[model samples]
Target: MVKDQGLSIVHVCQSMDLVDSVVRRWIKQHEAELEGQPGIGKPLTAEQQRIRQLEAENRQLRADNDPIKKSLGLLCARTEMTYRLIHQLQQKAVPVQQACRVLAVSRAGYYQHRRRGERKADVVASVQLKAAFVASGKSYGSRRLCRALQAQGVIIGRYRVRRLMREAAVRPVWKRKFIHTTDSRHALPVADNVLDRQFDVAAPNRAWVSDITYVRTRQGWLYLAAVMDLFSRKVVGWAMAPTMPAELVASALCMALQQRQPPRGLLLHSDRGSQYASLGYQALLEQHGIVCSMSRKGNCWDNAVMERFFLNLKMERVWQRDYANHGEAQRDIADYIVSFYNCTRLHSTLGYLPPAAYEQKMAAILPIGVSENT
Candidate 1:
């Protein structure tokens, strides 16, 4: 066979090393038949092989930079294939937990496509818009929805926010979870309501709200509890965990307390979730000398501030982001809450100034004007 094909001494060893003895004997016999063959075993040089591999990698990187290539879903689909191996390993219990650690996908997405039974609706366009909006974590709402739809080159009424949501049955994730967190049923003396749903207040740091939201990641769903200063509509502190333990809620509250150092009687309000109603949570509130209040059970309106925050989180950030693992989800949520939401987000309550900017402006003027107690 070696003689029948173009094979020589060195070429035979390199090509069929598994049968090296046979290959070598064949080559020797062929060589004995003809002492020296013309040109053989002249494969690519080491440098040439390296250059080809490098060029292949460079080509892929360049492809990634081209927006059309990436957005057309060709590049994205190709790139996501790397995750397939991890998923395959997971199927066999390989214990490789990518858990939103490596990816950033919208958890609430119905990207799964087909459901058990298909429900066909005439409003295809509306359905598409709703998917995008919910994918946006409801952050876009009506106005942002209009802008996003326009960007997609679809000229439709802004009112379609509600319409599309209803059609898709994909309402924003945290639309007032009737499942309360704080247990107001306790006999422990509850503090009187001072804020009393009065979200609109002058100046800054006068009022604050707290609530919890959840995000689904590869590891599992991570629950996030946070406290926001209503004056600026900014998140002050937040904690995330694989489990929604009471400490998770209190830790976030403590972080906020240490950071803001609100006045002697800052109003801390939240729902009747046990996390808030527990002795530890209530004690933390009393320790800070702040008044405590709970929204009436089964009432979403009483905690509108937190409800709005949850709505924003579910609709804007969590809806659009997919976490590869738990760490990524936790870290990303922290950035979204602290970096963007608090400092850059425009609050309708603060006359459009971001929470941080609103607070800074208030601190600048509070000594001379707006003499009012929170």
Candidate 2:
């Protein structure tokens, strides 16, 4: 009556038996509501009342749909993962039947999964599978994981291991492509491809391949030079420096020489990077009575073993880290080479034996007077 009929506030107050101040306040509130402003008290206009009713309906709809949205997201996950989630919900005072309905999973299936998890053998297998995966630095897939379980007398197959991995939500870290760091365009003299891709060697120290790769750090790039024995695919020697100078590679070579002390005529191979071709490096090779072989220009396959080693290094260790400084990266990489790669990591090429283990096993079997080559 106050807004549409434009009745005077005093007249309306007298007619409705309301106080004059209350009628004036209500008139102001009604005018504010006409302009789409909501007040705390009852809505006086039809449009304002309709707006309030819609808001209440919207709130109720959102409340009704929230559980459904959450359940839809959970249902979209893997079936085993969904079952695990439902079990977790059940532990939190949520009814199993309700959780199953919300997750769109059959109650019978959820119960079955829980029973399988409770079995002694299944539980043991799951634990062993996870333990083996972690022991491989989370790097082993189903094939190697199965072999590792068998080595421990677990009697698990590859397919079963894969299934358990899914149930346990275990997965290996993925590998990124290897980046080439070789700069062979310098005018320095590069040795011929004398090693000639003969990556297999009958005796340790008979042939070795070396390569350089860079690691990123907060401070700067750290260059790593490594020498691997082709006989065992072992990282015999490695050195890290803030810069990739000729001395960096020389230090790695010196370590290899000091460690192995191979006989004269040992063959060492590397890319034609200028550091490897430096006169000082060549002099060190000559002084040690070692033959220096270089990969052909633009061909990484000539030093393929070294390339593969770098790839494995980055994929399995270096790429997975975010180094804060040179020293940290150096130490971590050294640990990987000594503690993991040489000591524990399985190499398919060596019949799944680690390089160090393979070397030891071969040494124990070799005849005392006969050479590995013979």
Candidate 3:
């Protein structure tokens, strides 16, 4: 209007109630449009405005299609699977809100699904922990229980196992103090300390340690004599009777002889009790060509390995039960030795393997039919 009607630019600004700079900018934009040149800021031409609108729509369309392409087959999958995909996409720098929206899932629902899965996993872990504790006869502490759970394919740590044990209100049996009574002041012949505190034997049947412990039952005291092969710390033989007599120890030695049939020169060490020093027991040792080694007078540490076995027996099994009779105690003790102790218990000395398993594994790796000394 200023160019064709001879109206001044200032007059046009006043008529339109606009500032002078605004009118000047509009005129410059119109001149750029007539010359087919692009101008900055808001486009004054119709074609440029339509082009800007289409560019914005194209950007919005690409943003909407990107998540859809990433979640193609996932849309037909289960809701749980969809949530898992959403989680995976979020980890790969995809926005969770956008992914959930494209997959037709509510953001709150996806979060709730994740929480439910976590709770389920916790429940399964608790159940497995409880089962392992019970299977150990409530005798395993956190270290052993952690190993047990790992063996069962449960990935857990010792601290976590301890926490679970506390939550479940489960605990291992505690050991009690007991006195040792040995009749060592007898006039019977005593052998020298030939074994000499060498508890670690390189092969089975190379060395054996024997000891006797007393168990209380309703039928009075029951004495148990056990023979252990020092190599694997296994109870090779054991005998139980109402009295702690020479015959009881003899029977135990005989059982060990029949089972192992070791070569001559096998060393058998024991405390200098009357039963171990009895004429019959010494003669049996001589007849079998076994070497008899006696511990120092009143020194139990000489037979520390056997002493430890007895301690474990008392603490883990005998002390936990009120035995009604000798037979019951005998059966329970046998089960602990044969089924649990020898077959399943984790021995720290044996690299956390059971006695039987340790022996088997060594047999496979070591030479066949050759003694440790050989």
Candidate 4:
């Protein structure tokens, strides 16, 4: 009314008895809504309506043309994919020339790419198998190898994996049996089995298990004392020597204490061996404010976690070697513990994670102490 009919705001407000600002605000609010309406409003002209129709048609045409625009790129990528497929088929006894001709590719290119792809595949498979074997401590058979490869998105059958293993000459480590003897004939006082079989712990440094295992060398016997945290199953400390004495166990405990610096009143669980129950070992534990928890007399099941670790250490690394002397045995065992077991070897108890990784992962989420490797 104001623009088209040339009406005055003052005359409208006088006729309606309304404030000037209120009438102006009402006109401003309805100005957009009244556009393009008939009679009391202005509508789009024919040229403007034609442009809007053209824009709608343009959008529809572009959407319809999109698939055709991408078809050329798709065709080129498909040809390369087909070339690789033909190469793989040729390796399985398909005629390379016929496959190349049928796929509409050059026979020379097919042969060249096939050779390159095969060499690349062989190298890739060799590396993958070797990594899988080393990660498994060379303990995986073809079934495990196939599963490991498949987990990494490498689709390979077990029989094919077996052939690759044979070609690579990477055989699984054979298991060897051994015995661990604990001397419980001492007259030293034995603590009650406080830890018992409770392998689960709420936090690190709350409880630890220790044990002594012997390794036979050409020069003499090498003994290893290990301390494991119950929470993460990490070997927090270890000591290796040619003799199994109270100092051997004390040295391992000292290494654990110096590395972890765990809080006081930590429970130390072990078999009732004289080394663990000797005065020196007891006094050392007392000095660190650590308590003692002994396993039952001659009961190996009471300390099963430590026993399992020793079993893995022997079967995976020790039993496969012929150490010439204690030095060789100590060096190899230390490598297995530091380089492989604590850092690389997967533990089923820790959900297939190495103990160090498991502890670090737990430490990130839980309010627990961090464990250190030997």
Which number leads on lDDT?
Answer: 3
Rank by TM-score, descending?
A: 3, 2, 4, 1
Which residue pairs in model 3 clash with each other? none
Expressed as tens digits, the lDDT of each residue in 139-215 for candidate 3 is 88888888988899988888878877898787888868565658898899999999999988878888999999999
What are the lDDT figures for the candidates, one per model? 0.68, 0.86, 0.89, 0.84
Better of 2 and 3 by lDDT: 3
**Candidate 3 ranges with C-alpha deviation above 4 Å:** 9-29, 37-62, 65-118, 175-177, 189-197, 368-374
- lDDT per residue (tens digit) for residues 1-374 in model 2: 87789988888888989899877777777778888988536546998889999999999988998887678656775578879999799889999999988766899998888787767687889988888888888888888898888899888888888889898998877667445677888889888889999987777778989989888889888899999999999998899998889999999999988888888888999989989999999999999888999988988789888877777777778878889999999999999999999999989899989999999988888677534333
- Runs in model 4 deviating more than 4 A are 1-127, 141-171, 177-180, 367-374
Give candidate 3's whole-model lDDT: 0.89
Q: Once model 1 is optimally superposed onto the true structure by TM-score, how far is the C-alpha of residue 281 displaced, in angstroms?
A: 1.8
Ranked by TM-score, the better of candidates 3 and 4 is 3
Each model's RMSD to truth, in Å?
25.0, 20.5, 5.4, 18.2
TM-score of predicted structure 2: 0.66
Backbone collisions counted per model: 26, 0, 0, 0
Sorted on lDDT, highest at the top, how do the candidates line up? 3, 2, 4, 1
